[model samples]
Target: SIFASGTNLDVVELWFPRLSDEDQMLAVARFNQITSVQGSAMAVALPGIVETLGTLHARSYRLGVATNDSTSGAEKTLVTLGVAQLFDAAYGYDAVANPKPAPDTIQAFCDLTGLKPTQVAMIGDNRHDLEMARAGGCGLAVGVLSGTGTRESLAGIADVILDSVVDLPDFLSARVKETI
Candidate 1:
């Protein structure tokens, strides 16, 4: 549930409810340090992710990241995965006043890409991501099963539910044909 509703800071508050405000913040800092050490150790890219991103790029589709993680953290992971060059933009929670479940991240992407909200597709693995897409009036809200979301969580919100990002190219092709 942390993935859906809270950040690492929220974890400190949730787990140590008895802690005073000052102590909770201290706990958060320690928690962040622990996770930061673990983060780089677990930065592996999903299978075919690089290829999938390359496929999108070759088609001149804009690509980027919108994550609950910090922008610099996302960028570091991308660089570690050797896919840093594939993305056109990367926005994280801190980049916007309101994070997921709000329109901020999607709007940021659209603004930078010169895209109308209706021209954008928001692909993610959580209900918050889909909610944000809807709030921003995105053309498509795609949910993938690879991370925190489940079928029940995403069903009413997503325009499509994919097994994972590897399926994106085929899904995109199908959508293109439908329009044609």
Candidate 2:
């Protein structure tokens, strides 16, 4: 009955397929309201996040965000941080029928970019992120310790674990050199 793959919103549609569109709107509004409050305190970007994003962009790597947060909310945060233009695309829970761990969002992203799953890497700080990467057949599942997920929780799920996204550029560069 209940799936533990993703957030409550991700499974809400599965459980309540009969829910009226009006009711779904109300639920989304309520969730957005709650997130708005939480987002107030999170307007600021995490340390090294901007630099890492900029560096990744400069390296010609296309970037996209597959967040469970509302699209508007994620966009607002990115805009506020001055990195919105650095991203090629951003998908929220509402963008897909099923969110992370189901791989719908990841598939959508791949389709949009005309890239295969094997050409992509999913970098996240949670099990859902890693699961989504795996389900989508992504080449890499990278876990970070910068969010709520702990090392133990992300272990075995992620192909590699890092202290934070800030370390990603160096890690990727090293991998490229190793292959050369």
Candidate 3:
């Protein structure tokens, strides 16, 4: 089951592999245009997400999003979730010279916050996110089950596997020492 994951560029690359590079670029452009037009309406905020983000924000955690989506797309999703104000920043794949599995997004985050890689925690529901965390030497590699990854797939890769991001604050408070 090759579900849609990664940046729009990556997904579009997968979708149009045999096309000429220019055609692929055009395809990505069209895809992004369609997504910008329809993404917010298609978004579904996971239960407890708003509360979780609010809790983290209120607790003064400098939170940011490092998504594979385009920055605008990620912002739109957050807006749809009613939690756009909770984040300090949101970095899309385009925000970096390299995308996930490359450490670039994590590097961007570290640079923005003046935090060392080891002081940061990386959480996502896919392999690329965990891989990026490891490559960036992050303090934790957390995998959630609410998205594209299965327990079996994330096993032995992520430092800790949780059911969803809703469980993050408590786990981080209690288990910061365990990491990849």
Name the top TM-score candidate: 3
Model-by-model lDDT, in order? 0.83, 0.82, 0.83
Location of the lowest summed lDDT over 10 successive residues in candidate 1: 32-41
Q: Which predicted model would earn the best lDDT?
A: 1
TM-score of each candidate? 0.87, 0.85, 0.88
Q: Name every residue pair that clashes in candidate 3.
A: none
In candidate 3, position 146 carries an lDDT of 86
Q: List the residue pairs that clash in candidate 2.
A: none
Can you tell me which runs of candidate 3 are displaced by over 4 Å? 1-3, 176-180
Q: Compared with the true structure, what per-residue lDDT tens digits does model 2 show for residues 1-180? A: 223334446455665677798986677677666664567347988899999999999999989988777676677778878999999888877678887677997889889989999989899988989999999999999999998678999999999999999999999999889989
Clashing pairs in 1: none
Q: After superposition, how far is residue 166 of candidate 2 from its true place, in Å?
A: 0.3
> Which ten residues in a row are the worst by lDDT in model 3?
1-10
List, residue by residue over 9-110, the lDDT tens digit for candidate 3.
Answer: 878777788988899888877877677558866998889988988888887777888877778777888888888888878887777898778999888888
TM-score of 1: 0.87
Off by over 4 Å in 1: 16-37
